[model samples]
Target chain A: MTFDWQYIVDALPHYKTALWLTVKLATIGIILAIIVGMVCSIIQYFKVKVLSQIVQVYLEVARNTPLLIQLFFLYYGLPKIGITLSGELCGIIGLTFLGGSYMAEAFRAGMEAVTKSQIETGKAIGLSNLQLMRYVIIPQAFSYSVPGFGANCIFLLKETSVFSGIAILELTNTTKNLMGIFYKTNEALLMLVIGYLIILLPLTLFLTWLERRVRHAEFGN
Target chain B: MLNSGISVLFEGVNMQRLLLGLLVTLRVALIAVVISIVMGILIGIIRTSKNKLVQIPFRLYLELFRIIPILVWLFVIYYVIPANFDLNLSAEVVALIVFSLWGTAEMSDIVRGSIISLPKHQAESSKALGLSVAQMYRYVLIPQATKRSIPPMINLITRMIKTTALLTMIGVVEVIKVGQQIIEVNNLDHPTISFWIYGFVFLLYFVICFPLSRFSRRLERKWAT
Candidate 1:
């Protein structure tokens, strides 16, 4: 059970590929999630007819369920209905499905934080409905939502770990595969944790800085 | 076709097994939640101490849990520690330990947030009324903070429940694992059995979590007014 560095060195190339795949999947998933979130939030904000109820149901189901089961349903269950998704596609879709609802909640909270007086001010100034939303609501909402968006980004990235369950060769899967091959559980896992720290720590620090920047700009600190 | 897919749950002892597995999930989550709440309160109170030594370590602990995925923590505790320390623990034990550790970090943050968010005048008035420090906290702060923290804590409980699904990865016989077992046995006859089984597992979680989340939201709304 003594520590071994050579196993990590041996597994470095596989780790590299796995890291790339994880990054690629997470990036595409997050972009799509933001798009989904924006549309859902807009529907909710405007109280669009039937779509708001559909979004509510979508949010509840997505938020309550774990990504692993969702992946199982998508990867294993969907084939029963004649829809087959590749492992990578399943990973992306599951991530987007999960993340979109969370992002929608964040965006909705942001929109809700906009004051009624601000909207009235915009209306009183002869701004049309579209112009009011464009000029008054969106910017303030985006600024207020920065912290929530940052947290969701981190959450979505961490969730990509479950993509391994669907057979994607991501970081966790690569670590387990190496452990099985080399019997170097300690080294492989150490690298796995460190690899994630390497990826996440900088983003966290940057987000904290960005959050502070937004806060100061908002409050005149 | 729909009848055949639905028949998997009615098979021999399958429904019972899934319920037993679900009980195990709730058991693990409940135990972890209780332990985390008690320990988190203590840690949260300690964290408010103005000592850099105490605060720095707790900050590190929180960030460690926040930055890393729980799955990795599961593997580390389940595999690495037992091998290194010559200690053998069951999968359930490992799951409990990892989840409590994660939950404590989260709960402590919640506690810390609520404590700090109290108005400065509340503390000032309590002190001005000749209340001792302990008396002030016990009588004035703790009660208010606990009430403020309940909604978020309930939300955390729902999160912990959902997170227990990760236990299946470590081979814990939780609900999802039970669902997988059912699918394995029935896939030959009903190739669509997974859709039904996983769908049920999904609903099982939603049924448990939705009400809890709704309650939390209700409390949040009530308290806001």
Candidate 2:
């Protein structure tokens, strides 16, 4: 078989729209994940004993299980319990919870990396725990943790495709629909691959740049 | 109705199907792990190579693989490649190829990081002992790197196994797919069986993954001490 340039051209317009959906899903999902992750990390850091253990278990279950099952649980299971959300909302919620768990771990690792002496010095200056964390601990931790956070963000961006299974009309779902519609399986799937790369490549590059900047800042040179 | 669900799980024929599905999952994961480890080691070496050109491409390849979701890659490989190239491969083959590509990229990064994190003096001292590059790597460098690499490598293996669930989308009858089939069969009369069937699938994955998870942590502790 030979490459069909005409097929690719014909599919390009459809792929453009799918690429937009993919970008929207990833961007919104990641922003939500970062916010949820920060909140969960803060709670995990400061909450009392039993609450901490509950948060820890939540993180473990979220991380250990497959995202597909979790998506199914939210999209299909929640309605059974008298709580219903749109498929898109369910997808975003699932991605946020899953992504947040990993991001929380990254934040925790970052917090742990803050030197004891530095925290002690902040306290010696008569800073309360909250002030010490807000002023001294968190800023330093964020710089050191940027690479891990960036990596998790990129992972979340890709993982948003799992939303396709729940009929979210994202890139993968669109590709599958187009394939069934046109029966031009090859062209449709090729456009899907291109669609994913179009969205992911730039984000990957940006994250790499961000990681480098953070590393440079951390090392002071 | 509940009895039938339990019997479907334990009936000789159905039990065989579940066991066969389990074996297929294990087989795919085991083969993928072996292939990935070998490719990972080679790419890891290339990534840390003194040659700038080689290192740059390897780095790009690693990042691309890591950034692309496994499900998307599975779709691209199992559906796109065969259709694009007109190569008629089985779904299992496609799944293996895609998973190995992804796993190798991850493992290579892990290997590269662990190797680089080693003290520079270790390599320098080996060179001072008049060892050739090949001897230095073979005798001095790799043994230490292998120990450092085991925990992450095991974690990667568990990940690959869990990831096999995605193969069901491409029509490979793994355990999750088997569960879906059971649900479909019982849907007409007992729609609630969907939960039990899927719940069983979850337990199956947990059984397979939890041990590997424990083993990974154990190896991590052992290596640390």
Candidate 3:
């Protein structure tokens, strides 16, 4: 079958709206993930007793299962227990739940790379525990984790495509609906791939550039 | 007791069907992982070459797979190709192709990184011993890189296994689909059946993946020293 540009043209408005929702959801999800991740990493880093154990369980549960099942659980499963969430909320929560574990691992890696000598030196200088964290550890840990954060951001954004599973009319869902309606599978799928590339390609390029810049800044090229 | 949510999963052949679905899921992942490992080693070795033409195309391939979500790739391959081409592939075949291709891209990069990160002396010493390039790779590079690549490759297998859940969207009768079917069949009598069914599905995945991840972590730690 010949490819039809007209169907794509007609579907442009839907794609635009879908793209906006995807971006908004992904942004909110990533920001929340950073917050959740930071807390978990800090708890684990400091070796908090019961809380660290909880975070460990959360990490394994989040990391091992697929986001699709997580979304299904949140959207379809939770209501039985008298807790109901909107589709968008389910998408955001699922993204955060998965992204948080990954982001925490990234942060943990960065934090662990901070040598014991540096901590000893900070203590020798009479820096308090809080001060050591604020002035000594956080900055270096964050800088070291710059590439990880960039990678996680791109990952979370690409994950937004799965948001459609929760009945969010994001790009994938919109494209699927159009294909079903018009029976124009080629046009719809083309637009769907292009729609994702349009969103993710530039973000990937920007992140790679940022990562390089951060590396150069950290260690003199 | 029979009307309870948990009972819904056990009613009739539902549990058996879910197990069958799990088999499909594992089948896809296992086949894809095998294909990915073999192809990934070849591509990984080639990727270490100093040829720009080869490098650029593989880089694009890697980026394309990285940036695009697998579900979108699933759609394009499952729907787009069949619509345009004369050939028709089953959903299982499509899932295999997409996962294998994605796995290969990821696996090759891991292999390439391991190979590139080898100490300079290993290559120099091998050359000094008058080993040909192919012999050097066969004896020196591949063996060492295999050790480094194993943990990440195990991680990749877990990822592919997790990713096989997306096949449900393509109408593959995977675990999620089977659970959904059971949930639908039991919906009239049991409204809360989804929670148990989906929970069971989650546990199924965990049972398979958790040990694998633990093993990978152990390997990483053991091999690091």
Candidate 4:
């Protein structure tokens, strides 16, 4: 089958809508992940009481199971317990939950990697715990974890495709839809791959740049 | 009691279907794991080679696979390839190819990273001793790298099993799909059954993957020290 541009052109409006939905979903998911991740990682780093153990369990469960199963649980299982969520909302929850677990690990690593003396010096200066974290700990930790966060973002973008299973008409779902309408998998699939490449390719490049910059800054390169 | 999802799961036919579906998932994961290991090593070698020509294409292959989601790759393997050629394969077999394609690229990068991260002195010393390229890798480089590769490889295996869930999306009737089928067949009669059945699927995946994930973490800690 020859490559078909006409179908791609015809499907652009729908595809554009789908692309925007995907970007919106992923952005929201990533932002939520950053919040959840920061809290979980800080708890672990500080060795907080029962809360840290709870965070550990959450990380294990979230990391081990497939995103598909998590989506199924939120989309199908939650309704049984007297809660209901739209498919897009379920998608966001699953993405954030999984992405958060991974991000928490990054933040934990970054937090621990900060020089012990730096923290001690902040305390010597009479900085309160919260102030220390705000001025010193979080800034360095986040910068050190820049590459980790970038990887999580790329993973999140791909994970958004699975949201299609829950009836979210994101990019992958849009491709499936276009294929059904046009009866040509070639065109739809091609456009889908290119669409992903367009976003992911550049994202990967920028992430590498950020990673290098972070490492350089850290090492005084 | 007899109307519950557990009761439905205990029905002989349903039990057999779920078990069979689990087997399919395991089969896919095992085959993909083996293919990824062997193919990944070869790609890793090329990736670390001094030749730019060899490096660029493999790097592209690696990145392309990395960027695309496994499900999208599965769709392309299952639908687009068959349409382009005179090839007709079972959906399950197509699923395996997709997993291997995804896994090989992933595993290769892991291997390449470990190799490149090694001190250059090891290879230089081996060269000074007149060790052949093959001999150097077989004895010195690979032996050290393999240890580093294991924790990541285990992580990759867990990921492999997890992605098998996506096969359900492509009509493979894997474990998750079987659970969905049961839910669909029972939804009208037993509204609560979907919850139990799907929850069981989640548990099954946890049982299969969690141990592997734990082991990988343990390995990571041990290796770090």
Query: How well does candidate 1 reproduce the true complex, by DockQ?
Result: 0.81
TM-score of each: 0.97, 0.90, 0.97, 0.96
Error of 1 at A38 (Å): 1.8
Ten contiguous residues minimizing lDDT sum, candidate 1 chain A: A212-221
Clashing pairs in model 3?
none
Per-candidate local distance difference test: 0.90, 0.78, 0.90, 0.88
Candidate 2 per-residue lDDT, tens place, B1-225, comes to 454545556644766787688788789999999999999998886687878888888878876677667887777777667766769989999888988888899999988888888889989999999999899889988889988999989888877887787777778888767767766776666545555565566667767777787798898888894
Position B125, candidate 3: lDDT: 98
Per-residue alpha-carbon lDDT of candidate 3 for residues B1-225, written as tens digits (9 for 90 to 100): 324999878778889999999999999999999999999988988999989999999999998899889999999899877777877999999999999999999999999999999998999999999999999999998899888999999998998999899999999998999899899988778888988999999999999999999999999999995
User: Pairing residues by index, what is the TM-score of model 2?
Assistant: 0.90
Considering just the first chain, candidate 2 attains a TM-score of 0.92
Candidate 4 residue runs with Cα over 4 Å from true position: A216-221, B1-3
What is the RMSD, in Å, between candidate 2 and the native fold over all Cα? 2.8
- Using DockQ as the measure, which candidate wins? 1
DockQ of each: 0.81, 0.36, 0.73, 0.71
User: Clashes per prediction?
Assistant: 0, 0, 0, 0
True contacts kept of 2: 0.25
Clash pairs (backbone) in predicted model 1: none
Preferred candidate (TM-score higher): 1 or 4: 1
Place model 2 in a CAPRI quality band: acceptable
lDDT (10s digit) by residue, model 4, range B1-225: 324756877876987898789999999999999999999988987799889899889988887888998889988888887888979988999988888988999999999998988899999999999999999999999989988888999998998898899998889978988888888998777777777787788888888899998898898899884
